[model samples]
Target: MTTSPALDGPLTTALVGTRRFFTRSQVSDDKRSIHTEGGRSGDAFYRDRWSHDKVVRSTHGVNCTGSCSWKVYVKDGIITWEAQQTDYPSTGADRPEYEPRGCPRGAAFSWYTYSPTRVRYPYVRGVLLEMFREAKAALGGDPVLAWASIVQDPDKARRYKSARGKGGLVRSSWDEVVEIIAAAHVYTVKRWGPDRIAGFSPIPAMSPVSYASGARFLELVGAPMLSFYDWYADLPNASPQMFGDQTDVPESGDWWDAGYLIMWGSNVPMTRTPDAHWMTEARYRGQKVVAVSPDYAENVKFADEWVAAAPGTDGALAMAMGHVILKEFFVDSQVDFFTQYNQQYTDLPFLVALEDAGDVADTAEGADGPAYRPGKYLVAGDLDIAQAASENAMWKPAVLDARTGDVAIPNGSIGFRYGDEGWGKWNLDLEDIDPVLTLHGLDAGGTASETARVVMPRFDAYDGKVAHVMRGVPVRRIGGRLVTTVLDLMLAQYGVARPGMPGTWPADYEDPSTPATPAWQEEITNVPAEQVVRLAREWAQNAIDTGGRGMILMGAGTNHWFHSDQIYRAMLVLTTITGC
Candidate 1:
C-alpha cells in the first residue's frame, strides 16, 4: 500500500506508512494510544492540556465574601477551562488583608461550566423523535402489544378499578389528586367554621405560598386565630399581668442615665446579650450594680452585691425593705420629692387619718361633703440639709378644722393647705388621730385630710418605724397602691416634711390591695420573697443615695415568671418612693 504524505509528519505519522496496511479495527485500537503519550495526535495534546486546566480550576479554592481572581484558558478561540487564582485579587484591585475573594463553593465553577448534564439547547419532542429512531426501534412491539391488549377488552378497561391482574392497575392523572385535595379543603372550611380549620398540613414543612394562603384565609374569615403556643398548650397568661403589656418595664430610656443599676430576678449578662454590653460599660464607669434573685447567675458576677432570696416572697421582702428605708433615714433626702410626685406617699398618714376620723365623702360636693381622692405631685422643696434648715428656721403650732379643711397658721409661720377644699381638719397634735383612718378617709376612699392627718402626725413624731407600719396598712388595704411605704418612713425619719412646701394631695385613690398585690401574686409573677426585699432595699438605697438617678434593668428571666407584672409594679413603687 502507498503512504500518504499528509500522514508522514510528526502530527500524523502514525496514520501513514505501515499503518496504511492495517485494517480499520487495528487503526481504531492504535488510535487510542495517541491519547496516552508519544502519539502523533495534535488533538490529544490539546485535550490533555484542556483537561489539566479543568482539574486546576476544580481544585482552586476561594474565600467567601472577599476579592478573588478567576483564570480562563482558551484554545482555538474556544474557552476550554477556568479556575480561581488565589495569588491575585478577585476584583483585580487592592483589598484589605481581612477581605477574602470568593468562597470554596464559588471556586469550583467547573461543575457549572463544563457539566455534560446541563441543557445546552432547548429540545422539542418532535426533534427528539427524529433523532432517536434507533431508540424507537428498540422499544419494538411492546407499545403496540399494550395498545392491542387494551383494545381487545373494553369491559376490562371499564372494570379497571376492580381488576386484580399484574397489569390491571390503572394510572390516575395528577389533576384527579389535585381535585380531591381542593374538594377536601372546601368541605372542611364549610363544616368546621374557618377557625376550626387548621390550614397547615400535618407535616411541618411548608411552602411560602401555602403559608401566605393560610394567613390570608384566617384574616379574611375573621377567625379567632390561636398562636403556636396555644396549639402546643405552652402559652402563659402571666406576661400581660406582670409587665402591663407583653413585657415588663416601660419603653422609656430614663434608666440608662441612672447612677445605680438594680437587677431583680434578671440575669442580664447571660440573657440580654445586647443590653449587657451597655451594662458592662456602665459598670466600668463606676456605676453600682446590685443583683437580687433566688438563684445566683452570671449577671451576679458583675454585681457589687447579690442577694439570694426564697421564692414567692418578693412582696413581703419589698414591705420589709420599705420599713428599713423609712425607719433608718436611709431615704430621707429623697422623701420630699417622693411625697410630691408619688400619690401613694402623699396620701399616706394623712389620708389614713381622715378615713379614720370619718371626715371624707364619697360623692363630689354632694350632701355628704368633699370626697377624698388619691393625689399625685412633684416635690418642690430643697433636698439639701441647708435647704431644710432655712425652711424650718421658725416653727409654730397650727390647727386646721377637719370639716372646713382650713389650716390656721400662727402670725410668724406660714399655714399650708392642699386643693380647693383646703386642709379639712388638722390638729396641732396629729398623734390624737388614728393614722390609717385619717389617710384612707371615712368612705374608705383616700382623702387629702386623711393623708395630712396621718402624715403630719408621723412627721411630728419623727419615728420611721411607726411610719413604716402605718404606710403598709394603707397599702395593704388598697390594692394597686403605686407608692412605696418605705418612702413614708424615709420622709418621717429624715424630717423632709416642711409645713409650707409644695406637697399636694392627688385627686385619685389607688386601691393598693385589689389590683396591686393579689394581682401581682396571681397574675404577674411568683418571685422569691427574699429577692423582692433585697431588690426593694437596693433600689431604695440607690434612689436615696443617687439623688433619684437609680436605674433598674428587668430582663426576660424575671419577666418570664408567673408574677412578672407584680415584679414590675413593685419596681415602679420603689422608683416612685425614691422619686426616680
Candidate 2:
C-alpha cells in the first residue's frame, strides 16, 4: 500500500506531539470546541478518555440466585463499570416480556471487584507456605510426598492450621497453587476415604460452569461434592414433603394470572428485586394482596391486609387458616371442593394404616416424625405395601373401589405408571379409572388386607393412638386395628378438638366443639379468630369463584421451621381444595 500524505510527514511529530490521529489515512485534530456546557464539545470529551479502549460482556459470578448478565466496560485490562445486558432472546409470546435485571447490591458489585480486599493472586498462609517449602526441601521436592509428610504428622498439620488467622498470607503462583491443591487431594484421599475428601463451593445456580468444573474434577477422582442446601439453610424441604418432589414452581410472571395473592413471609421486592416490578404490576391488574408477616415489612405497604402474627408462629397461623377453610368453606359449602380435589390429586383418598402408631402428645413432634410416624398410606398389591413397593415403583397406592368392595390400583401413581405403559411415567390423572377414596368396605370386601401384615404392620406401632375414631376410614380391621384416611389423620394431627364424638379413639385428645373452630385457631396463633375466618372464607370463595386463581408466595421465613411440613401441608390442603 502507498503511504498517505499524513504518514509521509515526520512520524514523531505526527503521532504524540500535539498533532493527534496519526493514522496512515486520517487527518489530525486537537478537537477543541466550546460546543456545550463546561466549554467542551462531545468529540473533545470522548477523545480525552485515552484508556477507555475496550468493553467486555460478562456477569458478576456472585452466589446470588438471580445473576443478571452484564456488560463490563474495560480499560487497560481493568473493569470500569458494568450495566445490565438487555438483548436476551425472546422466550415466547406466552411469557411476559423481559427487562434488564439487577439489584442495587449487584449493580454496585464493581466496588468489590476493585476493592482492596479483593484477591490479587492465589495465597496460602505464611506459615503453611514455609512448612510446605521445608517439607518440599526435605522430601526431594515431590509435591505429594511433601503434603503427605505434613499431613501424616497431626502436630505439623495443626501447626499450620493454627497459623491460618495469625500468619499473613504469602502470595502464591499459579503453578504452586495447582501443585499444592493436587498434592493435598492425593494425600487426603489416601489417608481418609474418598468421600471424606469433599469439595464444597457456593451456590451453583449463579454460575453453573464454575461449579460443574470443580464438581466434575471431584467426581472424576471419586470424591464427593458436599451438598450445600441444608448446610446453608436454603433447602425448601416443604416442597418434597407435600409433592413427593421438589422444584415445581411457576415462573414469577404467572403472578399476573392470579386474582388473589398471599404474600406470606417472602418480601418479594427485597429478595427478588428484578422481578418485584412484576408484582407491583400485578397489583395494578387488580390482584388482591395479603401480607403475612410479624413486622410491617416494606411489602406490607402493597398488601390489602397484614396478618402480623409473632415470629416463629407462621406455621400455627397457616394451620389455623387451613382449619377454617376446611370446615367453613370446604365442608359446609355444596361445592365439595375439598373432597373432590382430594380424590383427584392428593393422598387424602389413599388409605392410611391406622393401627395406632402411638401416644404422641405434641403435634410439633408429630410433624417432625419422631414422636409419631403417621402410618404409611396403604398401597394395593397382593403383597404388603413394603413387598409390593420393594421393586422399582412397585408399590401402588390404592383408592377404594366403590364397586366390588375391593381396592383398584389407579393409572397415575408412580406404581401404576410403571405397571401400565412406558409413556408418561409421572402422569397424575384419574380420567378413565375411578378408584375408591374411602375405606368404608375395607374389611367387608375381604379382597384386600386379608393378611394382617398388609393392614397393620407391627414394626412401627406405639402405645397410644394418635387419631380420633372417626378419623379412621371405617374399614374392616385386622384383629381390631382399623384403617383411616390421611385427611382424617391430618385433622387429628393438628390438635383439632373433636368433643362429644362417640367412639373417637384417642378420646383423651378430642374436643368435638374445639377442633377447627376459629376460636381454637385464634388461641393457638395470636391472629384474631374473626380475621382468620374472614381470610379463610375469602380465600376459598375467591379460588372457587375464579376456579383456583389465588396464589400464595412463601419463602425462607415460613419453610425454615424445623416442623415446616405442617405449614406446607396446611398450604397444600388449601391449594388442593381449590385446585390451585
Candidate 2 regions off by >4 Å? 1-61, 67-96, 109-112, 123-184, 231-234, 332-334, 356-373, 383-393, 403-405, 419-426, 432-474, 477-482, 497-530, 558-570
Model 1: lDDT to the true structure: 0.41
Put down candidate 2 lDDT per residue, 1-580, tens digits, no spaces. Answer: 2334555455644443433233223233432211222434556744543456676777665656665777776766766666788987875876455566777877778778779988889988887788888999998989999988887789998988887668588899999989999898887787786777767755677667877887788888888777655554433566677776765344677888898888876788887777777678788888889988889888888888998877766655676667766555533343655556667777766665644435432322212221223556566543344335433434666555555554555556666445334255456666555554444324444333322111111111135443322222234442233555565455454433232212222222122233455565455557887797788888888888887898888666665655555565566667766678
- Candidate 1's C-alpha runs over 4 A off are 1-217, 225-256, 311-316, 322-334, 343-538
Q: Write one digit per residue (lDDT tens) for candidate 1, span 1-580.
A: 3335455466665543335365322333334322122444657765764653332232332211122455666555445656555564232223122122344444445556667866555332332222223232454623333323332446533444244343432333455334334443454456565665554321112244554666666667655544432332212333443223443443323434677877765576554432455566567767788876767788888888876545544543443444445433332233545544443222233311123313332211221222222233111121222222333322322222244432222221222222322244222334332222122222333322223223222211224332211121122222222221333433432223322212322111111222122222222235443454455566666666777887666544444435544545545545555666
Clashes of 1: 80
TM-score of each: 0.35, 0.69
lDDT: worst 10-residue window of model 2: 452-461
- Per-residue lDDT, model 2, residue 310, is 75
TM-score of decoy 1: 0.35
